[model samples]
Target: MRMNYEENAKIFKAVSDQSRLKIIDILSCGERCACDILEYFDFTQPTLSHHMRVLSNCGLIEVRKEGLWNYYRLNINNCNKLTLFMMNLVTETKDCICNDKSKCTCK
Candidate 1:
């Protein structure tokens, strides 16, 4: 169940920004139009576009166009994959006990 380090790093980088992280949180509930997302912050449209581009480029979020509006949503599958990767990295020895070192066969 190994994951690509580069892809995961990109996702992490996309979310590393405060604004982008806020956008991710907004999208967590459901899909949203660009204007709706823009209303939550004080930044201009172009700034929001830049954040959205970075997010979409990293595959952390998805976009769709409806007339003149652009809708965005969290890419749940990719988000879940990233979550699993983090959990696996932290719990690499899930089957191993703290008291037993030599008898461990978790791998």
Candidate 2:
């Protein structure tokens, strides 16, 4: 399903931070426990939790609780939606009325 602009914006915001981007990259490899994820970073547990919360809230990642641990993985469905949104944003264009005399570069 297509996501609304606000939802897409949230996803963009979630990835705006370097920490969160790195978190997503880690999750991209496969599902991993929160502790395992923490090992890959130098930040505190709370900081990692914050990043995970943002990613989960934005629908960019999914989380599962097993005992005292939270496992995370990239949400493929939402990722695909985000991909389509980006593709449309970059490729969808309006027709321009530029001619040779206008010096417009739209080809």
Candidate 3:
């Protein structure tokens, strides 16, 4: 599979934060309301909102509105893509970038 470096970089950046990683772990269990997620941290609601926005923007999580509440769940497709990306990144394959060394200037 071809990888889009820029898109994958954005995903890596979004989850770089400790708080965001925890949030993803929480959502991994199942869908949750914003309020329910907020209970997991000591930060203000706005902070949680910021983290949620980052996760949402990166396509890692999906959000839905139910009256005054916003529900969140992991985007399983994107999560699986990320897993595949990581696996491809580490494992050698015929398509590996290093295999195309024609661009190499070193003797």
Most accurate candidate by TM-score: 3
lDDT of 2 by residue, 19-94 (tens): 8888888988999999999998889999999999989988899999999989999999989889888876666344
CA-only RMSD, every prediction? 4.8, 5.5, 0.7
How much lDDT does each candidate structure score? Answer: 0.88, 0.84, 0.96
lDDT of 3 by residue, 1-107 (tens): 99888999999999999999999999989999999999999999999999999999999999999999999999999999999999999999999998889977889
Query: In terms of TM-score, how similar is model 3 to the real structure?
Result: 0.97
The parts of candidate 2 lying over 4 Å away from their true place are 1-3, 93-107
Ranking by TM-score: 3, 1, 2
Q: Ten consecutive residues with minimal summed lDDT in candidate 2?
A: 92-101
lDDT of 1: 0.88
Candidate 1 segments whose C-alpha is farther than 4 A from its true place: 94-107
Q: Which candidate model has the greater TM-score, 2 or 3?
A: 3
Q: Using alpha carbons, what is the TM-score of model 1?
A: 0.84
* TM-score of predicted structure 2: 0.81
Q: What is the full ranking by lDDT, best candidate first? A: 3, 1, 2
Give me the overall lDDT of model 2: 0.84
Distance from true location, Cα of 107 in model 1, Å = 21
Model 3 ranges with Cα > 4 A deviation: none
